[model samples]
Target chain A: MKKIDICLTPELLHLYELTDRIVVVVDILRATSCMTTALAHGVEKIIPVATLEECRALQAQGYISAAERDAKKADGFELDNSPFSYMQEHLKGKTIAMTTTNGTLAITRSREAIQVIIGSFLNKTAVVEYLRSQPHDVLILCAGWKGRVNLEDTLFAGAVVDELKDEFLIEDDATLGAHTIYGCAKYNMLKSMASSSHVKRLHRLNLARDIEFCIREDEYQVIPILQGNALVAMVKA
Target chain B: MKKIDICLTPELLHLYELTDRIVVVVDILRATSCMTTALAHGVEKIIPVATLEECRALQAQGYISAAERDAKKADGFELDNSPFSYMQEHLKGKTIAMTTTNGTLAITRSREAIQVIIGSFLNKTAVVEYLRSQPHDVLILCAGWKGRVNLEDTLFAGAVVDELKDEFLIEDDATLGAHTIYGCAKYNMLKSMASSSHVKRLHRLNLARDIEFCIREDEYQVIPILQGNALVAMVKA
Candidate 1:
């Protein structure tokens, strides 16, 4: 059996030997979720830029733009990082130039991996199905909040791990750690993590709805895969 | 009141503004714990080097040396990174040089902070008491396993937050996150985190006793403080 592991946070990355693995990048609240939703809702593709300047520059070439910072939609962009924003009919058939605080950085970091797929609760089943067909080792990259391991990303990784456990060998400590956290929080994830610093921050900013929305499982069937600098929906191979 | 927080892992570090806060480095498995035990048992000041070569050079200078990698004591060192090894009567009154994978790196990274202290469950009460008296903002630097967040450090940070909750306002998400984990683990910390990746790895290596020893609260009254290149017991002001 091939070794499959999850890096709970990007900082745990140094321990990973990523030469032959298929890396899945997850930022559940709300980068990957937004990307997955946008693609599922018929947005053409997403250009994930690491910075606002990159998003604006991409938008200058006439692409629609979406930007987010601190979990809220950035001003002057065509859209925000919220999944609700991506569910609009206007976004259908449009290409989005998107930038976020953490998720975009994770995608950029995993460019060296053989394959990089975006994983979120929004497209959990699709991502798992895609991984099941591939014979490569899997590495779930949790795009934790601003480089810190937060609850949502790890839980998403756990959700993936729960699905793939029978097929892959969990090799890393992070995978085990994330799974343990997920098992502990699965009953009432939002309430269990209510005191989480990220949750508290979101609550303070009046973004509690976003947290509740992000944790809903398998809401969409689209699997977003990285193609060069952009993420597009993967067609069945 | 200024915000005092500790990043339990480098991943969660992105949320912290490290410019002005005092960061106390803690890695109970077992760098900080070893350092506290060494100082408490009457060992003369200890030098924490980042690499084995640095430890070797200090060893050549007639200083007793210790080094650890991946939770195992380094080969050919007089002392391993275990707190048990440092509790020997022979270690008393002798200056020692030490190096480990995570804790030392944390200390080096936080060298620019206004002040740095070593914290562990063993010295919990003393550490909390000392932080309560300091005027500068406090940040707990959990020298996580390698560069990732580990359970013990975050649990210890939560203990600090729980202790200092009345005196300080926790502003960072990492702090809030640690407190949540602590709340979940407080009733039976060992059981709650018994399956943690690090703990399981330690158990597999037959180091379960070390985990139990490391989590014992208030076992040592000594609080380690960083001064010049060494961490010595803080002489209470």
Candidate 2:
């Protein structure tokens, strides 16, 4: 039987050998959600860079860039960490060089995996369909706040595990924890996540709309797949 | 306002500088629960050693000892990681040297905290009552399985947060995640933990009854305090 494991945070990457596993990287609060939204709206590709310098260097090469940190847009970046920011009409067919505090770091750290697929509540079904088609083991890796585990990403991981747990063995306590949390919050995602640290933080910064947008299920049907340092929408056959 | 936080793993001890926080260490699937059961049964003090050598050294110096690893009793040890084993008739007024995989490591790593109190479902009410009287910030630290985060500890941490969340400002996503899980599992503790990795592991070893005893709420009013090198049941005045 295929196994389903959850690495709750990128810091736990050392715990698993990711030789042939399909890694689904989730940052549901905004990063992956934004990437999914961008791809759904016809954005060509997203180059997720780990550092601000790399994003800036890519921007100098004429690619549009966005930067975010501590729930705010970094200086000198045209866009911040909002799903709506990535939905601009001009962004259609334009490649984006993006850097965020959590998502970009997770994607960069997980570069060694066989396949790294972007996961978000916005694109859950598409990602799930892709996972069902794969013969390899699936690992839902949450891109937590900085290196510590966060609530929103974990809830997303749990949601995926809940849908596909019967098909594979639930590997660890962390995975079970995620599945349990998903059971609790699956009924009302918005209300359940209202008190989450990231949601609460963004609310304090008057970004409540972003939280609502990020957690909206099936908002995007495209599964963003990493190919040669860029994430582009790919339809699973 | 006072703040409430939860560190789900001992590996996160470095992320927190516990200068003014009342640190409550919870190892709910057995260690802290065992300590609580022992104290409630009138055991004098527990010398929690992180390493087998330290436990052995303490044992050699005229103290009863118990050693546990990977959900099983270690070789040459008279006792295992069950709460019922500590509820012995002969254990009254006796000191013990103990070493376990997760709990002892958390207790050792949290040596820098201002106050370290052992927490379990058995002593939930007493721990909460004590926290209510404390002016310092509170950090519920879960001693997870090995260095990885676990479901039961996080659920226990959440249960504590659920009670005290209104009184204090929750600090981070980890805390929120814990609180959410607690909200999910509060009504049916056993059912919620039925699928956890550790519980299933112990169940396979025929330790199903231990799981029942460990999750019993407020079974004991004794809160074990880490005083110098020993854990002694301390009643809050």
Candidate 3:
């Protein structure tokens, strides 16, 4: 039986002796959600870089930059982390060079796994469906905020664990913790997390709708897998 | 108003430019609990070292050794991480040279903070009561298993947050996540954490009693504060 584990925050990556596991990187508060939404909306490829400099440098290579710093659009970047921005008509078939505070950092750090992919509430079913097909043990990697654990990411990680709770042999305290958190937040996520620091911060700044849209279950059905540093839609034949 | 934040694992220390805040280091499985118990039971002082070598070296200087590695007492050490083990008749008025897998590591890493203290379910109220009196911001640093997040430590961190939720300005997602986990586990800590890996591991080894005893809320009322290189009971005036 394959075991399912989780690294609730990317900061814990150094503690894991990761190898041959299917890693699903989740950043529910906008980054991975945006990436999932981008693939679902027909973006050609997403080159996820870790630094703002890398996101800027890629523009020279004909990749349109979509960068974020601390939940806002990077000062000079052409795109913010909003899912709605990924739905633009002109971005179809174009490659996006993207960087964010949390999501991209997790993607770069997860290169050691057998496979790395993007996941969020927006594409929850697609991710769960795809993982249920893979034979290897699963590792849900939460791209927390700037090297710290965040609620939205933890909630998404937990949600996936709940979805696959019966299909896999859950391993470690984190897997169980994520499962417990998801159960508490699934029915009324916004209400459950009304007091969470990130949710409260974003709500105060009037970004409540982003949190609202990000938690919508199964809104899109797409799994973005990393193929040599670019996230492309994993199309099943 | 002081802002209360959390670094759930040692890996997040870099993200926090910590200053002027009191850091409560928690290793709820057994270590911090043991330290708190040792102090509550009138142990003179505990010199917490991060390695087996440091603990062993102190034995030659007349300090009794207490060391654990991979959840068991280290070879030739005088004691393991069980809190019950600390309630010994001979342990009173004695200074223990202690080292554990997670607790000592977190204490060592928390040197940059204004102060570091030990916290566990055993000394829950003592820690909270003391924090309520202090004017400084509080940071509950969970000493997770080997730099990774663990169930018991995160739960203890959450308990502290819940106790202080109304009094402090909680600053991050990890803080909120901890509080939520605490809420789910408060009424039935053992049952809520039955599926967590550490609990199962200890149960298989017939140490279920230790788990039950460790989660007993406010079982002891001693606050162990780091004084110089040793953790001594903070004498209240």
TM-score for chain A of every candidate model?
Answer: 0.94, 0.98, 0.96
lDDT of 2 by residue, A1-237 (tens): 889998888888877878898889999878999999999999999999999999999989999989999989999988898999988899999999999999989888888889999999898888888888889998888998877888889889988988898788876888887787888878888888887778888998999888888888898889999999999998665
lDDT of 3 by residue, B188-209 (tens): 8888878777788788878899
User: Residues A134-166, candidate 1, lDDT per residue (tens digit)?
Assistant: 889988988887666677777778778888888
lDDT of 3 by residue, A1-237 (tens): 878888878878876666988999988878988998898898989999999999889987778999988777888889998898999999999999999988898999999899998888888888898889888888888887767777777888888888788889976777777778878888888887786667776776688788888888888878899999899999785
| Candidate 1 residue-wise lDDT, B203-224, digit = tens | 8889877878888888889988
Q: Which stretches of candidate 3 lie over 4 Å from their true place?
A: none
Q: Model 1, stretches more than 4 Å misplaced?
A: A2-4, A11-14, A71-76, A162-168, A192-212, B10-15, B18-20, B187-194, B197-209
Worst 10 residues of 3 chain B by lDDT: B170-179
Decoy 1 TM-score against native: 0.87
Overall local distance difference test of candidate 1: 0.81
Q: Between prediction 1 and prediction 3, which has the larger TM-score? A: 3
List DockQ for all candidates: 0.34, 0.62, 0.74
lDDT per model vs. reference: 0.81, 0.88, 0.86
Worst 10 residues of 1 chain B by lDDT: B171-180
